[model samples]
Target: MFTGLVEDRGTVQLLEKNGSAIDLTLEISELITNDAHIGDSVAINGCCLTVVEINSGTLKFQAGAETLEKTNLGLLSQGDQVNIERPLAADGRLGGHFVQGHVDGVGSIKSIDRDGEWITMWFEVPEALSLQMVPKGSVTVDGISLTIVECQPATFSIALIPHTLEVTTLGQKQIGSVVNIETDILGKYVQKLIPLKLDGFNERQ
Candidate 1:
């Protein structure tokens, strides 16, 4: 589990395709790599990737076909910036929300509206993914936990403060930029149970 608080912004150093999978290398700060080791889990752009190799300040991970199909990681280039977060320790505070680093779906920036230093960005996602969101609920975009400001049938909006924009990859995003999105785990569970309950009620009636 992760708290969704971005620890550092890592730069993509390499992306080499080997058959159906791609080997990714990122050069991050010592803040994350100093204590990180092979076999540790890291959240890269909201996707849970295992650390397969650690050399100097760079970490290597492999993305299989399933991960590529479900996330925006495949679109990454050698010089792109990605949000990086380590898993929350058992005694650590949950400053953000519980983030599994599991991308539920891919969303694209539909529009961006700025007011002073704050931003309200709308993302267009699949209807199935939007159904799991609610106003004021928690959502993870590119691994930064944010609250839903408004929820629509096929899109949702989030308010981003200056600190968030400055610290994470959201600052570099533009219209049509693709991002990884993970809806709240609680919302997913509730959504799963509701349909079964409704079906049972209808059968009894």
Candidate 2:
């Protein structure tokens, strides 16, 4: 699992397609690359990927067909920047909410509004996913954990501090740019259990 806290940004060095899968190589930050080893799980743009090789200050990962179909990683090109984060360690602090690095669905930037030093960005999300969100709830966007400022029927907004804009890819995003989104895991669990609880209550009544 990941905390949705991006440690550093990496440059895409190469993307090679092999049948239905693809091998991704990134020139990652030295801080992460140096400590990384084979089989370590790293979240790339909120998609959990396994380290398959480390070569000449670069890290390689394999993305299967399912990942390519579900995420924006498939749209990556050479020199493109990607958010990178190592999995949360057993004793690590939960600075951010629990992010499984499982992209629920892809969303697109619909609007960008700025106020002083803060930026409020709205994303057009699938209606089904939007229904699971709440105001002030947690959501992972392009691997950066953020709080939902407002929730709507088919869209949501989040406020980004200046530091967040400077450190993550969201800073470079523009209207119509696609992003990987992971809704709150806790919310999903609650939504799933409510129906079962209602059934049990009805039986008791």
Model 2, total clashes: 0
Expressed as tens digits, the lDDT of each residue in 1-205 for candidate 2 is 9998889999999999989999999998789999999999999999999999998779999999999888999999999999999999999999999999999889999999999988999999999899889999999999999999999998999999999999999999999999999999999999999999999999999
For residues 112-190, what per-residue lDDT tens digits would candidate 1 score against the true structure? 9999999999999999999999999999999999999999999999999999999999999999999999999999999
* Candidate 2 Cα deviation (angstroms), residue 173: 0.2
List the global CA lDDT of all models.
0.95, 0.94
Clashes of each: 0, 0
lDDT of 1 at 123: 99
| Candidate 2 off by > 4 Å | none
What is residue 200's positional error in candidate 1, in angstroms?
2.9
RMSD of each: 0.9, 0.9
Model 1, residue 90: distance off in Å is 0.6
Question: What's the TM for model 2?
Answer: 0.97
